[model samples]
Target: MLTNRNILLCVGGGIASYKAAALASKLVQAGANVQVAMTKNAQQFVGKTTFAALTRKPVYDDVFIEHDASKIAHIDLADEADLIVVAPATANLIAKLANGIADDFITTTILAATCPVVVAPAMNVNMLEHPATVRNMERLMADGVQLIAPGVGNLACGWIGKGRLPEPEELVETLSGLFQAKKLENRHVLISAGPTIERIDPVRYLTNDSSGKMGIALAEAARDAGALVTLVHGPIRGTLPSGITTIDVESGDEMLEMMLTHYDQQDLVIMAAAVADYRPTVTYDRKQKKIDGPLRIELEETTDILRTLGERKTTQVLVGFAAETENLEHHAQQKLIRKQADFIVANDVSRADIGFSSDENQVTVYGKDETVTPYAQQSKTTLAQNLIKQFAEALR
Candidate 1:
């Protein structure tokens, strides 16, 4: 997939800089035009000559040194790159990138690059865990930067923790995976996201605290996989993603309508929305005034959209999401059978850190064949990419 691709490898100042050189070689061997950019401190660890020899391209290290007088070197590199990867990203480099401080050659070029930016952070464990670093990294992720999370092992600083750069081979695999040929090319995907609002009255409604980040992330991931994605969403907390068909609905019934409307044309259907399971049995058309006593609302079950879709699925890969507070895998497995879904993605919503309204999530996927895959806590975006790829493969 990396054949004939232009990859910008930005090296940072860290012991892991050596690994970056190896990574450049691997990318070149995979048929990518690898261009290397190094920070001043990175030159100390791995000389520019080493990278030049491996990539057979000039290694850029200075912002002022322009080989061509006509075009700005940084801008030219940024414009030509298909992807930008900052491996062995030191704490200082990360901060600089996060804050848009372009003092160095690498930082300046990265700032100018509009392509996807992937960062692999390598630093001391303490520096990795510092509040400022954490905040900066979060900002970068929020700004749509892909993060290759550091591994946990013995560090160059002699501290044992999660600040080690992954091996060259692993880095190459991960980076190559990012540019994989679109598995869902020309396929149609239907995704539902956000919280369904069940109205009790004109001014009152019942809804969960779902922010729709996961669903939106899934839509983006599916789109990136080259699918014609149609996103059926509810009231989302953030801006909706572009380059897809997005239909806004307020209640489960509306979402159901949108999903079923696009169901027959979809190759894959993912029910990621936090749909309200129940709605008021008696809904008031007008806002009711405060009663002297506590008012009660009788509720009825909403249509099970996932089960409906699963029943109708013929050539489609059907996936369901189960948000459980207890007995997660059991509930997911049960849902898989009951809903007749090919896979059930279950997550513990009880965790304060990684579910519902949060940027990160951890999910266990339960397949119909009793295959259970537990994914650790990670950004919803990354998880969505993995899930979309798996679903697309299953569809094929």
Candidate 2:
């Protein structure tokens, strides 16, 4: 898939630098012209000779190399590449790129490049969570750089957290996805995600166990397809996918308002949020004191956002989700018909491993023609990709 692509691989100073050598070989095997640039400190972990052997090219590491005015290798190398990849991007290098510090050849070429840049960060858990590093990462994202998130596992620093670099094959797959012409280019997608909170008192609320993993996966998949995606998210702790515009909200009412404001602008709308069906009529401003007796509360129905949007939708594709414990297909079909949604994704939430907070899900999609497609248990990310692919085909 990456045939004839020019890839400049930047290896930074980290314990994960050894992975870069394997990554270079993988890229080369995939028919990419690979060039390696290494930081001086990186040599301690992985030798420059290994990279040279893998890529069959001279490893660039100096700013004052063979010092001739016409032989400015950094600029030349930067201009010749189609994509720049930084594996094991240490906190120092990320800060340097974010702050435009070009004291080294790698940073200098990064500054000089005009193509897309992808970074895989690897460091101590504490360093990854540091405020400065987080800020720098956000800055890089705003600048259109793509980050392949670090895997969570045992780190060299004796910490167990998310600081491990993704495997070499995964990095190569990410690069391939980035360079492939996006299938959903110029499409506008609006997605609602997470479980909405319904307040009963200042400290008490009604919510679900939804972790937003499915919705987040869908957002990431849509973004990868080159769609202009706006994610209306409820209270969830998952990371927002790179390149998506996120609007965070706490309650179902707020989510509804955001969706109403943006839905008209989209060609597709997916209502994946698990909104509260009922809420306390009177929400106390302060925490209510619990008595040693049963408490009685007046409940009212919340706004049906999908129904409202379905009523207003004209040519836009509208999709809804149903999490049911009984009569799943019957209820989902009724929801699809009643809400006027084009399709309903229904799943049995009673299965502890298949729904709500789980990383994997199994769902059945009901279409207007009563056609049901069953999706077996799989990672939410993979399921999202499948859903988007089907949606894109329907759009076409």
Candidate 3:
């Protein structure tokens, strides 16, 4: 995917900076036209000659350098770049980038670049976990920046936690995924993810084990495929990539409202949320007393978001998720017919290894025409891309 592509690699000042060099070498070996740039502190750990030798391009650091007689160095590099990557992104440097600070050669070039930017963070455990650092990362994500999450292991600072840059080979794979053709370009997609909560009282509510991983994966995949995605989700522990329009809702009603609000503008809609089947008939203002042996409260059925969308949709391609422990195919087929979805993605959530909060998923996709295609277990990230590819083909 990197064949003859120009990559502007920005190395930050950190012990993990060596990994950045390895990444540059790998990119060069993969047939990419690699250009290396570094922060002032990075040159202290690795010499500019080391990078220039690997990429075979003059390492850029000083913005005022007279190497280019006709063009400005940073602007020229920015214009030539197909992608920008920052490895070993220290908390300090990430803060600078998140806030659009252009004090050094790397930051200045990044600011000038309009291409996609990937940030790989590496620092001490404490620093990585700091509120300030988390906020900065969130800000960058909100601005559509993609992130390669740091791995967890022993740190150079004697702290044990997540602060390691991913391996060079992994970085290369991620870049390849990003550079794939934007097949869903100019398409607008609406997705609902996570488990909605049903409140019985102000202090108590019923929820599920959904971590919103699959839905998040779909959102990222759609975003990468060049679709304008709007994500309506329940509470989540992690953050999605920067560009998605995200909305937080606690109850199934709220989710339905948000999805309907954007329904007309979407070319595709995926109802991935595990909404409550029933809600309390009468919500109490305060916690209920525990005096009685058994609490008898009436339950009411919630709105069927999938069925409603199918009934009201015009040209939108509707997809629904069916999480079942038994009779997966039967349930999936039933949903495909009853909900009028174009495709129903059914999964065996009974398996402990894949589904629910797991990072991986195994599913059998049922179509409107009674086709049942099973997908083997794989990371949610890869599964999402494959699903999108299939869906894109199905659309045609």
Candidate 4:
């Protein structure tokens, strides 16, 4: 997907600098032409030679050096880049970027670049939470910089908390998605994801294990494909992509309502959310305190969102997700027919590594003509792009 794409990798001064080397290599393996730029402090962690060996291009760290005037190296690099990525973006670097301080080569190129900029921050938990750093991050976001938040884990500073950089594989997947062809350009896509919460009381509610990662990924993928995407998301812990419009909902009925209102505007509809099959028949406005006797609650079925969309679908392609643990194919095929969906993506939630809150998934796509396409286990982001590719081809 990254074929012929140019990625300017700006390495910042931080202990996570070594991860940048792996990031560069991963980008190359994924068919991107990578150019490495580093801060002077970054060299203390990873050598310039390593970046050169991996990218097969001279590492740029000095701004005083002169290149051809007509083809100024920094400006030329910025002009030609499809995307600029800053991995291990230290506090200082993030601040400089947020404030437009171009005292160095990395910041200079960033200031001169016209492409999308993505920054993955890595620092100690204290630094990450510092008011100055937080303010700077907010400024960058306001200025249209995409941030991949640091993961939470053990840090090099011996403190166990947030500020760990995302793994190289995940970063590679994100970058690849950013530069993919805009197959869904000029199209509108509506996607629903995550589990809806039905409030039993102010203090209690019913929901599921759905993390909404897959649905969010689809929204992002569709947006990257140049589609105007709207994600109707239930209560989810994961962050939404930067540019897509999001509508938050709390119950299956609410989701259905939102979908019905916006469904007519979409060229494609994807029902990936794990809406509650059953909701409390009666929801109490106030908290229900602990009762001495056993408590019982009546359950009622929620609206059939997918079936409704399938019935209303005309030229728009409707996709549904079926997560089954047993008789996966049979169940999925039945749902595909019953829901009148154009395609149904089925996965086994029995596996611990994929599906339902997991980072990876392997799915089988069942088309209306009984055709099945299987995909290997991959990150939700990658899976989303693959699905969008298939959808785009079907449209063509």
Candidate 5:
């Protein structure tokens, strides 16, 4: 996937900077046209000559050094890159980028870059956990920078925790996935997100705690993967991606109608919405006043949208989500079979730390023929990217 692609590798000032050299070599072996840029501190650990020898390209170290008299060095590199990778992203560098500091060659080039930027952080465990560093990392993610999470192991600082750089091979594979994100190009993906509202009265409604973050993440992930994505969501807490088609609905029935309307044209359908299973038999038009005594209303079952789509699926790959508090695996397996879905992504909503409205999630994917794939807890964005990649492979 990296074949002939232009990758700008930015090495930060850290012990893991040595690994950045290996990463550059591996990227070159993978057929990528790698251009290395180093911070002043990074050159202390690995000289610019080493990078130039590895990538066989002139190392870009000084922003003022314009090899071409007419073209600005940083601007030229920024404009030509297909992707920018910041390996061994030190706390200093992370803070700099997060705050828009462009004093150095690397930071300046990155500031001018419009392409996708991937950051691989490596630092002392204590520094990694520092409030300032944590805030900076979060800011980077909020700015749409892709993070290759640091590993947990013995650090060069002699402290043991989660600030080690990933192995070169793993980094290469993840980078390759970034390029292969276009695997779903020309394919149409339909994703449903958020919690459907089941109205009891004009003023009050029944809804789950879903914030639609996961579903929105999935939509963005698929869109980044080059799929024509359509997001059908109930009342969501967040804004939708600009490029994708977004349809808003208030109830499960409305969601079902929208899904059915677009089902035939979809290459893949992911039922990520927390659709209501029941609604009041009669929705009160006016706000009901305080009742004198216990009042009861009839409840009716709403349509099972996932099962309906599964049954109607012809060439489309149907996927369902099971938000269970107990028996996660069993319930996911049951849903996969009963709903006739190709895969069931199951997560425990009981965990206050991960699922529900949180940004992180841990899910187990259940497939037909008794296949189960368990994924570790991570950010919803990362999980969505991984899942979309798997689905793209399946579709291919």
Candidate 6:
């Protein structure tokens, strides 16, 4: 699938640098045009000759060296690259790239490259835990760089922890996904997001902490995969992406009505919104003033949109989400069965660092067949991309 794609592999100085050689070989054997570049310190562990012999191209390490004599090597390499990958990315290399300190050929070429860049961090556990390294990784990710996060295991330094480069086999799959085919082409996707507000009075309402980022991310991903998306969202503080249909709603009933109206036309339905379970039995025309020491408000169950859709659905894949504080997988499995959903995206809202308002999430996807897929903490955008890809596969 990666045939004819020009991939530049940048190897930083680390014990994990050896694994990069295998990655380059894998890409080359998979029909990718791989070019190897190494740092000065990287050459200490893996000789420049070794990479040249493997890639059948000169290994680049210096910005001063001119490979073509006319074109600057760094610029030429950067211009030809369709994608650049940094395997065994040491803390220094990460910091340098994040701070724009391009003093070496590897860094300089990366600075000149306009293509997508993916980083696989490899360092000591302590170094990875350092605040500086953490900030650098976050900054890189924020700058639109993809991260193939490190794996957890025994390290060469005798301390077992994260910071180990993911095996070359896994890296290959992640890179392939960068250019995966758009399996969702021509498909219509319907998505619901954010927390639905059930009005009590003009001044107050009942809602959850959902910020709607997950649903929005999925909508964008679906659009990117060539699917037409309609986003039914609640009142939330975020901008909508262009090229997709967007509907605003306040209550669960409103969202349900809109969804059902458009349901038959969709190929996939993702119920991601944190819809209110109950709404006030009675709503006053005006804000109620504090007249008594205690006020009683009766509640009524709102519409069960997922269950309703499951019953009404035909020739469409139904997906639901479960946001729980405990027994996530158990709850997700039950929901998957109860709602007759094909899959349920379940997450523990208990983690303060992720879910709801956070930019990242960790979730386990439960399928009706009892199959489960777990995804670790990552940006919602990344997670959505993966989910959309998998969803497309499920359709096949």
lDDT of each: 0.88, 0.87, 0.87, 0.88, 0.89, 0.88
lDDT of 4 at 334: 98
In candidate 4 the C-alpha lDDT for residue 91 amounts to: 98
Question: How well is each residue in 133-205 modelled by candidate 2, as lDDT tens digits?
Answer: 9899878876777766676669999998778887787678667866766778989999999999999888899
| Model 2 spans > 4 angstroms off | 66-69, 157-159, 201-224, 235-248, 285-296, 304-315, 319-390
Q: Total backbone clashes of model 6?
A: 0
Please write out the lDDT profile of model 6 over residues 285-396, one tens digit for every residue: 8999897678889999999999999999898999999999988877888898889999999999888767598767889999887789999876676778889988898887
Candidates 1 and 2 compared: the better one by lDDT is 1
Better of 2 and 5 by TM-score: 2
Best by lDDT: 5
Better of 2 and 5 by lDDT: 5
Provide the TM-score for each candidate, comma-separated: 0.74, 0.77, 0.78, 0.79, 0.73, 0.68
Q: What is the per-residue lDDT of model 5 for residues 121-227, given as tens digits with 9 covering 90 to 100? A: 99998998798998888788778887776776699988876788888887887788777748789899999999999999888888889989889888988988899
Per-residue lDDT tens digits for candidate 3, residues 1-396, read 899999999999999889899999999999999998888899888989999999888998888884879989999989999999999798988999999999888889988999989898999978888999999998898787877767656888888766878778767877887888888887998999999999999998878888898898899989899999999999777666567899999999999999999999889899988998899989999988787587787899999999999999899989999999999988999999999999999998988767597656889898897677888766576678778877776665
Q: What is the Cα-based TM-score of model 2?
A: 0.77
Candidate 6 local distance difference test against the native: 0.88
Query: Which stretches of model 6 miss by more than 4 angstroms?
Result: 186-267, 271-305, 308-316, 321-334, 345-387, 394-396
Model 3 lDDT, full chain set:
0.87
| C-alpha lDDT of candidate 5 relative to the true structure | 0.89
Give the candidates in order of TM-score, highest first. Answer: 4, 3, 2, 1, 5, 6
lDDT of 1 by residue, 83-195 (tens): 99999999999999999999989999989999989898999989998989988887887787877767666988898767888778767766776798889999999999999
* Higher-ranked by lDDT: 1 or 5: 5
Among these predictions, the greatest TM-score belongs to: 4
Question: What is candidate 1's TM-score against the reference?
Answer: 0.74
Per-model root-mean-square deviation over C-alphas: 5.3, 4.5, 4.2, 4.3, 5.1, 5.8
